[model samples]
Target: MEFGGMLSLDFYLHQNPDGGALLDWSRRLRIAAGAARGLEYLHKVASPPVIHGCVKPSNILVDVKFCARLCDYGLHFLASQERQGLAGYVDEEYWLNKSGASKECDVFGLGVVLLELLSGRRSDYYQENVINIVQWALPLIKGLKFSELFDTRLAIPFNIEPLVRLARVALACVGNSRPNRPCIAQVATILTNLEMDLY
Candidate 1:
């Protein structure tokens, strides 16, 4: 059960002792795309169609090839009376409505992960006007200020189109309503396309 040549995105993102991000812009794109594909497989392509109740940076393991493998895919099976979720990644609605969490909850969590990836910060990242990453990044993303929003820990690239698109998709995933949220497949498509466009 031990997987080597891989490190959790959480470590690369938050647990670094040097206080900086390990993933570069392109590598971050790869992780985002790969994680989206994994979620897509779980929500849409699996035989029984599993839902990844917990989707966070810690659950995403990145390999040497910069590919992302989603861990803790079905931990909701072990749910207890207490709310089941990570503080930054879990949706309040998921706790209130425990029925599959309607898949949107997973999407929302992935959105938080994307925000973390972009900011090179943990999901609990906060600012004066923002309660979380989603609140802080959405407006900057909308204003086409992605360069301003990116993690300064890594050197920003001149061509940041992929970051712009990826952030927009993340924004859609955290929509206020279930119907407003992008399906897991759509999220994968957007992220994968952005990944391919990176080269």
Candidate 2:
């Protein structure tokens, strides 16, 4: 049950003792792939097919070897009641009581996580005019301005092909309506392929 490290994915993505990210591009890619597979297992392989209501980075724990382990699965009802943690991670439909915390909503959260990994920003991040991570990154990705979409803390990899593909996946997961969002299985396949290409 216990995977290892106490640090959450958010720690490496946003908070670190050194005031900088601990994960580089390759490590982030590994974490993304692992997290995707974890969600995929929950959605497709689990006996009851659990929906991880809370799919943000804090719920994603990172192991010693940088593998991602999803925690706090199927706890969205509690989070939804409290409305404490769910922010930009959840889709617009999640707020409408009738269409709350479905598999598609989980995919939306995973999409936000992917954006966080790529931009090293929080899902709920805000500034003077900018609203959230999805709002900020989607435009850059739509415009094919990938150079501006990456986390400045880490150097952009020479082979940006993988990141571009990842961005497109994120776009599909978040940009589309709930009925149109790609399933977690599809997202996992794309990320797994990207991870394999790295090796």
- Please give the TM-score that candidate 1 achieves against the real structure: 0.88
Candidate 2 clashes between residue pairs 3 or more apart in a chain or in different chains? none
Which candidate tops TM-score?
A: 2
User: CA lDDT, every prediction?
Assistant: 0.80, 0.86
TM-score versus the correct structure, for each prediction: 0.88, 0.93
Error of 2 at 40 (Å): 0.8
Give every collision pair in model 1.
none
lDDT of 1: 0.80
Candidate 1, residues 1-199, lDDT tens digits: the string is: 3488888988888897643545888888899999999999998889789888789888899888879999988877676646434555766676576574558888998999998888876666333454777777888888888778889887877877778787888888875567678888889988888888877
lDDT of model 2 at position 115: 92
Please list the residue runs of candidate 2 whose C-alpha ends up more than 4 Å from where it truly belongs after superposition: 17-21, 125-129
